[model samples]
Target: TVIEQYEFCRVHRKEEIIISYKIEKGYPLHIDFTILPNWIKSLKDELLKIIKGQQYSEYHVDAPGYYGTKGLAIILKTLTEMFVQSKILTTNLCIPQLLSQYLAQVLVPKTAIRLIAEDFNNIFLDMAKKIIID
Candidate 1:
């Protein structure tokens, strides 16, 4: 009844990790993920194949939209966003080989993560703007 134990794919796990980052100053990449248990791992591979093969999964992103595939979708979305941002920012920012060091010593450690701890000021500002505009 192991499958029965999982109320939802991945989310059914007793633990999940939340990663934080500085979105504006720079969404520095810091992967804080744990390996899935063997039981979940087994099911994930087949499910992942099916999910990735979908042509327009977003078209079906509605209620009850592949609940079993939510975890895979979320992981793909985050990585796509991060890497695409990285590509644009690296070229525009003109950061040299010291990218990792710069992200670590300068951005992440600066102000003791004050900006990050603030839940990103820009996001709040955007929400406020949307509310006012609407």
Candidate 2:
């Protein structure tokens, strides 16, 4: 089953969208990510409740030490290191927005994006193949 397919456009940073890709478009796509403590403590339980309600139902982080959300914990970790470097420090969403644009443009191009999409499609096809084989 194709779960969802969407295109991300960088209107402000228009140069970022090289190609649209499918993040995950099939069943058995494991979105179950790890959790972190820093995000939980900093963002708080209220935020977590909201996230869970939105179907981001995974938490693989220890509390009090990391204090970060599972999916975004890596970003948080990087941001903290940047803060230590005397860079701009704040709860600014602009950084993330720009980073998103970078991913759309620089990291994931049309070919790469298409590859990932095909991968998802292949997963579904393989599952069907397996059922037939069984």
Candidate 3:
């Protein structure tokens, strides 16, 4: 019998992000991903809509002093996640640092990040379908 395994990992730093993947035999492999809450996905969609300038009437109001740029939603969301996950000694909320890091890493080149996210979704869907079929 033949057994194969695959492993993936990512390292983050101020300079650059590094990703590694390897395949081996005999040894077991495990993958772990932080499951983002559904609220985050909804927020991302809302931010995307605003950035695309498809705001509805409810979102038309302006604050006391601001351009009402759609980009603010993303910025707020990032900060919220950071503050919640960080859980500093002084703060009560437990910010998720890993998610913050992942988002920061992807947002460097926005267009490229979007394309890569789309590709990852498609590939994962294909893999899911294969799993169902077999």
Candidate 4:
């Protein structure tokens, strides 16, 4: 369902990162990086840790659980950090706009929302607070 609803495209060129999402029935959303932010550049080690720490198999399994949502929240949180550190306005962000479409569609079904919400609570709310407080 998530795959059906959203499509992701990523490209790494020389020193730039470009990530885009194509939502069904919605225009494409892009997160283009012409230059790396200092904060992101400094987090090379942390980024490696994040990538290395994931349980990749859980992402591939066809199950109704929090794994997918956890992954999504991680991306969202990372994007949030990027925007904040770059001093970019939230209005320019694209993931939230793309995600809003998916959320709207999921609301109609309501079956998967619980797991998503659980993961959101754990990864986005709780972890974010801890990171900020610390």
lDDT of 2 at 23: 20
Worst 10 residues of 3 by lDDT: 59-68
Model 2 lDDT-worst window of ten: 59-68
Error of 3 at 85 (Å): 6.3
Each prediction's whole-model lDDT (CA): 0.31, 0.31, 0.30, 0.32
lDDT of 4 by residue, 11-85 (tens): 234113311222331221332222223323344443333333331111222222222344344433444454344
On the 0 to 100 scale, the lDDT of residue 101 in model 1 is 35
lDDT score of residue 52 within candidate 3: 39
- On lDDT, the candidate that comes out on top is 4
Better of 1 and 3 by TM-score: 1
Worst 10 residues of 4 by lDDT: 55-64
Please, what are the lDDT tens digits per residue for candidate 2 over residues 1-134?
Answer: 23332223334234233112112323223333243224223333333232224323222222211111343345444334433234333325224436444323322221122222333463453343332222
Candidate 3 residues 33-108, lDDT tens each?
1322232343455334433336421211112011012333443354355333444211221133243442333221
Work out the TM-score per prediction.
0.21, 0.19, 0.18, 0.21
